[model samples]
Target: MTLLRRLIRLLCGTDPVLRRMLKYWAATCVLYVACIGMLLVQVELGLSNPAAANGLIAFGGCGAFAFYLLIRANARLKLEPDQLAVAQAVFSLVCAFWAYAISGPLRAAMLIMAVVIIVFCMFALRPRQTLVLSAVAIAGMGATMWWLQAHDPVRFPPATEALTFGYLAGALLSTALLSGEMSKLRSRLKRQKRELTEALETIRLLATVDELTSLVNRRHMNEVLKAEERRQAAGADTCIALLDIDFFKQVNDQHGHAVGDSVLRCFAAAARASLREGDVLARWGGEEFLLLLPDAAPGDARAVLERMAERVHAMLVPGLDGRRISFSAGLATRRAGEPFADAISRADKALYQAKESGRARIVLA
Candidate 1:
């Protein structure tokens, strides 16, 4: 059984819905083929007339088509809540009626098949839909049996009548319990899937963001730079500015790494505040950050970086013993047909000029 399960998993992809639909249709196809094969064998044994045997084969063929349609429908349709509800209801009715139609061991087999369908529907359908389907199955089956007994007597014997009624009662009871349990299971699975997806996204974001400054990290900065290059290459004007905390090592020595981190966070906050909507900011490296300013010229880039640097120099970092943080910025506009790396290198060189002249100033390269 475990080997068969693994084989099925290998044949199907990891998507739960696609896997289920594929398994359902595959199993249905195998079942119909087996039924046809059995009927053909029975005909060969002379246990049934050729006409009845052919008719059974024809019916099974028709059922095979219906299952094919079901498979096609599953693939083609984008099953919304209302559509799934309708499909569940229809399947439930079909199962119940199919159970009441067969006889003897075949009748028992149909009853079990009905239970299996109900269980699958219960798990796949929403709770409200499952409840409605369960009620529909029980009521429809019971009413059908009552009508058949009243309308015909020769079709069923005393023992058959008793067995049919017992089967109906048992199917109803089993389906109701199964529906309840499966509803809870479905809810739990959905909740767990949602939580798992959210956790994965949170981890992905943490991997991309700097924990100290909450800015895009160096890894994500590379991605952003690539994207910015593409955007600028498409005829959009852009600039790259490199900002470095002035005398950051001295600050860490005078204060502490905790206060240094606080200063970095404070600088990031001010930089973000000065940025326009389309500008991108990231922690390029330790005490160094990069900003990709879209649709900006050299003068605009210098003005924004200068204002940001002044803002960082004025703000008192609470954890830095009320000391203010200062930074130097190098502003460079995108040269026509220039690579992003070249532009960044020019801005980095200008930043060195800012520190060379004096700390806490902006230099345009």
Candidate 2:
């Protein structure tokens, strides 16, 4: 299994369209080999003309190998979609010419193969290109019939020649129209899928992120806290710090709500810069935020919050002249298997102690 996966990775890489095309080409090669084998068996059993059967087998085997190599080369080159479509159309025409030459009694059946090729091209080529390729295919089939009739007039009578051409034309037209419609539907579905994916991503961001400060919202923070508590229950250390801006009400009263909002945004940005990668900062409420420090005890968590406090104190709000920002923080480490409510309550109590003791200090519980 590992070897197979490695081989596929080496061949197809990460492009889904390339992988699908590879699978299609692989299937086609397998079908070609099977048909060649059957033709050889018929020649051995004296059920087919030895000379004609040998020639057809040799031609088919070489053609299939050449086609496979061409596809592989194109895959390696990473050709654009338009170029690949043209290459495939040319290959299909060549195969149709071969089929027409050797068809004998099954001449009409070979036209079906040509129709299938044109229909397949609809997915990758525009309708106009598909129509053009269809015309080329019809021309190739007509030329093949003319050559065959010239060589052996008894087989392709002049009377049936008109009927054969008419059938090929009608088949190509109908298949092109139907396949063109299907191609349009496929394109519409692809566009809708892309739009839906983008919309889902936006909704997910709005649900979990605070719009104003770009921090995780309180609701999402609670979910994170619960998850951390579960990790704590498994003997991992985690701590939570509740932060409140000092005299934030005065900033709103004196400066205006817009200025207050700017202050909050600046503070949030500074706090994020000061914290470690594993720490999570979330907007708790108006002028309040929560920081979750995973794999940290109360002492380490307090040190982190103290650094953040110093950073926040140094931030300069534009409309506040030179007044500095300050925040009071309370840190509480979760005990093994302790409930989330109990830990938050302890942090709340410590926060109240810090507010009472001094406005710009951290209290650890």
TM-score of each: 0.61, 0.88
lDDT of 1: 0.72
The digit string of per-residue lDDT tens for model 1 on 1-365 reads 59988886666656777666666556655755765565566567764467755765665567556644654466566665346435644653564364345432344454555555556666457666666666676666666666656677566454576676677667766776777787788788989999999999999989899988888888888888788677667534688989899889988998888888878888889888988888889998899999988898778877788778777878888767666678888888888778888889999999999999987888889
In the order shown, the candidates' Cα RMSDs to the true structure are 10.1, 3.1
Summing lDDT over every window of 10 consecutive residues in candidate 1, give the lowest-scoring window.
98-107
lDDT of 2 by residue, 1-365 (tens): 69999998886666787677677667666756765675566566665577776776676667666655665676577777666666766766776676566656655666777887787677778877888888888888888778877888898775576688889989998877777788789989999999999999999989899999999998998898787766667535788888999999999999999999999999999999999878999999999998889988777888899899889988888999899999998888877777767777888888899999987999987
Poorest stretch of ten by lDDT in candidate 2: 39-48
Model 1 spans > 4 angstroms off: 1-157, 174-185, 234-236
Candidate 2 local distance difference test against the native: 0.80
* Position 289, candidate 2: lDDT: 90
| Predictions in order: lDDT | 0.72, 0.80
